[model samples]
Target chain A: MDSANERTAEEVAWIHRIGQGDKAALQLLYQRYASRIFRFVIRMIKDEAKAEELVNDVMMEIWKSAASFEGRSSPSTWILGIARFRTLNAVRGKKLDTVELSQAPEAVDEGEDASTGKSQEQLRALMRQSIARLSDEHREVVELTFFHDCSYKEIAEILQCPENTVKTRMYHAKAKLKPWLKNMGLAEAELGGVT
Target chain B: MTEQRMDELLAWYANGTLDEAERQEVEAWLENNPDAQLQLAEYEFMQQSVAELGDDEPVFNTEAGLDNLMTRIETEEAANEAVGQQSTSTMLERLQNWLDETLNWNRTPAFARVAMVSQFGLVLALGVVLLLPSETNEGYEVLSGTTPAVIAAGPTATIGFNVDTRLVELQQLLREQQVVIVGGPSAIGTYQIELPKDDLVEARLAALKAHPAVIYLQRNEP
Candidate 1:
């Protein structure tokens, strides 16, 4: 089997053992997923403490509901779905969406001139700022696609949206990032002829 | 595929998650449209950049998280076990009392008393065996009124109020039904309420269910 399928198989097995009240299995699952879940949640909510709390909550939920998992989706997908649900709830409860982008710290240093010779790190920082500026829906599509390594279908599953919507969001996200890429000295032709 | 469609698939292509057919289609398109190669290269760079975004962020302390979760699981299990033990103890006591009242072993002859005692021993042993905690019985208790105390007290129901339901309005409604909130606002925002008396449980439940604020309600099954 491919690596993804093998990972899924291993996760499923751990979940089964967890269902049997095996703490070791739960620990193994936690070790595998806690960081990933935290990263996704921290990106979503932008709160480190809440993200850590949610990671624990998600793991605890998996422990409680392991037996109920029928394997309809890959374990990673299911776990991410749980994380997304919890993070959304927390976001709604706190009205975190009201937080303005202007309040967000800039990713790029103002002292560094983009036109002058820039280091790779500076370019990456600018890229991060461009990405961080995208709307939540668009940024999520980008994050799930590139960072999480999820396919369109898996992204759809995590976001509970249509696959076409995922694709469209990614398209919009890239379109929004194009100007920033151009400003960062990338050639226009290199940006896929995107308007 | 159209250029827009191919553009949409480029991210997945760079991520190497496209199916073989889709991969081939993208490859063929790229072969014909050589300019698309730069776009594909840009996508690969975007992926690398996004992946590295977390590199500067604080690392999640997995061991600490696991420790916290384990502690929570242990506490929850302990609470559930206590409830189960209490239930079992109450059941055993009730069984013993019923046997005493029915058999009246103290008033019987010596031989008859001995036989009755032996039978009571067997019955108690069976009760203990049956009531031992099982896999299905252990863990979080979803229903609040399933406990022995709640079961003996009165009827209860789980209700989910509308998010927009006003506090005063909810109070008036619960006051009319003579029920008090017992547990929850669970993960799904459902609450467990205990009714005043079991006499008009069905009518009280119907009234509660009919309330405009009562979006969801389930009668607690003991």
Candidate 2:
């Protein structure tokens, strides 16, 4: 078997052991997925402490539900899906103020300067800000696609949304990102010599 | 395709996930649309920049979090044991209950129910693949003398192999582990192959490293 299949099988095996009450298997799982989950949750909640707590909550949910993992999606997809729901719930439960995505400025005058001539780090900072300004749904889709390298189908599974919804979110996300990238002049800089 | 459909295809195009035919179509579309091509480049640049955002940067300490999880799992396990369940049937019973509650198959929209059932079928098919006997009872053959023998139990790594290695050859080498190509050589020359994850990950890595055809091995992170 190739590595991806092997990893999936290993995850299934871990879930099986977890079903049998194997703490070691659960630990292996924690080692495998915690960081990724942390990054994802941190993006969603934007609170280090809360994200940390939610990560544990997610692992706990997995610990309790590992037995029911049907291998329909990859273990990572399942875990992240669980984390997404938990993070959204935590956000709602806390009544946190999410940015009104519609209010995001179309032009970033200051970011444009950084994009055209600034270092890659500066451009990345701009990108991060652009991501932060996205609506929750758009941002999640963008993060899954760009940072996690998930396919549309995987993102759908993670978000429990339809693939077309994923595509639409991504399209709107890019639309939101476009003006920011344009303002930064980052896109122009990157593609300056392309055509 | 409409403008909106083309826009969606552009995202896939920049990601290098588009198949050859789709890619060709996108490329053809781009020929007359330099603006779209620029957008594609911008998307590619954006993706790469985003990927670099969290490069080995420590997010937060999870050791304590893991400890808490272990504690809860132990607590739950002990409580269940105190109930004195001997047969594995109880585990299966609990799993069934959880599945019913989680999927809520009865109330889920028709589309979700279909996805759930399809996923179940795929898993069952995989289980059958794993159970089938191969040249080695453990399910994989060591392609070279230097390759260490490993007993397949659970867990798998998705290794990217050289482009020249044929799929049929991989099937012969992989044996009981299903050799599914999940991803590709893209701009870089690598074929992402999925195999059953098992204890013999190290052995498998060593075997692949020793094999002349394996290009790169990466463990898929969820």
Candidate 3:
């Protein structure tokens, strides 16, 4: 959390520069938040190709109107909110069949093993697939909590849900995964006690 | 202890949403209950499992991320641009309405438009780019031709010189309407010249605007 605070402060400097009409600062801001925005959008839309295109639009828009930002919220929060709004609109208009999770390639490789021939990639890929199977709301809670490393409060704020609601969604997500884990031939002991 | 109660507390515990007192109460109960112990493990399992998922960057795929950004920018940009156009049109309509209701816009179009736009105070300037003399094939042609000396010359009057330096001087003495020529050089390193009497008055002013340092127009006889 301290580190995230520091990152936010640095990003605010970039935001300030953007407010002053600095094009370079605007690009830096785009690059800084592009992945975060992409993840949120992709997770919602579940369509990699479309998500990538939307991310570029988000960046171009940032460049075009950096001056419009009034610092009503921290730049990160504001960008994330914009991403959220965009994803919501996109998902609303999109057909359910458009977000086919099986079609998109893995987002990250994570690679096969750190020391030996053991492949973390396979494990990570499995994890991603499992998470993708959750309901949109469930997956979103997991995404906010695990991937973004957001605290429950932050997730609540981002999702505009009550704190308890976020907890409930997270509880549900974990419960949905139990059967899958049991099939993996791993219990608490095998998966490093799952902690 | 009931599994339902344990499940409830475990959810709060996993979220770290429990207060200190409730947390202590859970901790005290978990110290003895085996079922509570398993539930505690379940809660811990959920938290760690999600944490270990380590999406550090969920939208790490460059191609997808850029695509997402582009789509968003389009919507926002279109919306903002619409708002901008609407506001500008609104202001224009309001001003026109006010003018029609309050003031004498029955004035001439030229005067009314000028006053209206002038309030915006946006000045636009344009400057012509000049080429260096060495870069021009026409440098020699202008070197040889003659020009009138000044505006009073009725746009055509004799102004001539023979050498580069003499031409330079002559240019200094002519107006935009004035024309000058070079008949060639004399033995004394000066130019043979002619200057029409009619343009004598405005020759100097025209020469300044014509870049006198690089051209010359002969002065009219004083």
Which segments of candidate 3 are over 4 A away from where they belong?
A60-75, A94-121, A191-195, B1-222
Give Cα distance to truth, residue B211, candidate 3, Å: 96
- Return the TM-score for candidate 3, rounded to 2 decimals: 0.47
Relative to the true interface, what fraction of contacts does candidate 1 keep?
0.64
**Share of real interface contacts recovered by each model?**
0.64, 0.45, 0.19
lDDT of model 2 at position B91: 90
lDDT (Cα, tens digit) per residue for candidate 3, span B13-116: 65665667767777777665665565556545445554553454343665445455556656777999999999989998998888767765656487776876
B1-222: candidate 1 lDDT, tens digit per residue = 699999999999999889999999998888846557767766776787788854567789888888899999999999999999999899988877886798764476999878877998999999999998653322123444343332326666778999999999999998998888876666667887888775788999999899999999888666
| Higher-scoring candidate on lDDT, 1 or 2 | 1
List the candidates ranked by lDDT, beginning with the highest. Answer: 1, 2, 3
TM-score value, chain A, candidate 3:
0.75
Instruction: At residue A170, give the lDDT of candidate 2.
Output: 88
Number of the top candidate by DockQ?
Answer: 1
Instruction: Write down the TM-score of every candidate.
Output: 0.66, 0.58, 0.47
Top of the candidates by TM-score: 1
RMSD per candidate (Å) reads 18.9, 29.9, 23.7
Q: After superposition, how far is residue B12 of candidate 1 from its true place, in Å?
A: 0.4
